[model samples]
Target: MAKYIDLQTFTDARGNLTVVEKILPFDIKRVFYIYGVDETERGHHRHKKTVQAAIALNGSCRIMNHAGEGLPLEEFTLDKPSKCLIIDPEDFHWMDNFTKDCILMVFASEYYDKDDYIFEPYKQI
Candidate 1:
């Protein structure tokens, strides 16, 4: 399952601020941003242990969730800057239907390691 997090935002004459703490149930060890993707679908795997949070910064997009929990796939629309999707470990995830100039900022609780990820997709049996 996924967790929708409401980030704290402050606005004034200068600009707006969305605050995120890297501590609590876990700590942030990696951060990255995605942009300039029109037809590309990113992320097709589940982490072995790392947990992640995805935040949309620019345009809107759809996130696909397919965790191996004997349930159907789910879709989430992320369009707000303060809206975040918290992806649990072993939750197979992907992104699609990105609007132009879409930016998705991701924060993770672990470093990037090829061995720490599962990339096999579901197959009919």
Candidate 2:
């Protein structure tokens, strides 16, 4: 599995903003956005070489992830203004139970390629 780098955010009396100057470990090569309603669960897939950082820019969303040989599945709920979840290769991830106007921002090391994606259904835990 790949490593995680959590970006830092600072807040003051002015406002809060995410800083992305020269702290990223990898060069950002691609960006994607997912926004809308999720009546059912979605994104049960794996990326062979894509390392991604997901941020909830608007509303909240739930993320389910499975990584490593015997690593147990984990779930995360993101709703803060600057909180984010980093996902690495070999991890199966999905988004579920999102709000009506939830906005998900993803930063990737590579562009989108169909050959790099692996879709799978939710299995027994």
Candidate 3:
């Protein structure tokens, strides 16, 4: 299942600082970001073993996920830098409805491997 995590944030006169430490279930082996997106949606697949933690570093976006067959679809909004979404291997997911300035950063548990990707969305039940 996909779950939301609240990252620790410190606020002061300067500004706010959010940290991602000892929160993710897996060690980040790869990092990536998505920006400059248009009307089209992104992500419509699940991984074999990779786990990902997605954060909205700049603006906001919406994530839709399906755990598996017979499971209900889950929707989440990444609107804050302190909000993290954990995407498990079994969770078929896609991202959409992004703000123009949205910057989404993902921390992956494994390096890029084309063979690990399963380009299939779960059928809603």
- Give the lowest summed-lDDT range of ten residues in model 1: 19-28
Clashing pairs in 2: none
- How many clashes does the backbone of model 1 have? 0
As a TM-score, model 1 comes out at: 0.89
- Per-residue lDDT of 1-125 in model 3, one digit per residue for the tens? 99999999999999999999998999999999999999889999999999999999999999999999999999999999999999999999999999999999999999999999999777899
- Give a tens-digit lDDT track for model 1, residues 77-121: 899888899898878889999999789999988999989989886
Winning candidate number (TM-score): 3
Candidate 2 residue lDDT tens string, 3-122 = 334557877999877766575556789988888865887788888888887877889898888875467788888776477677886788889888987898888878889899977633
Best by lDDT: 3
Q: Which lDDT values do the candidates have, in the order given? A: 0.85, 0.76, 0.96
Off by over 4 Å in 3: none
Stretches of candidate 2 above 4 Å error?
1-6, 121-125
Backbone clashes per model, in order?
A: 0, 0, 0
Model 3 — TM-score against the truth?
Answer: 0.98
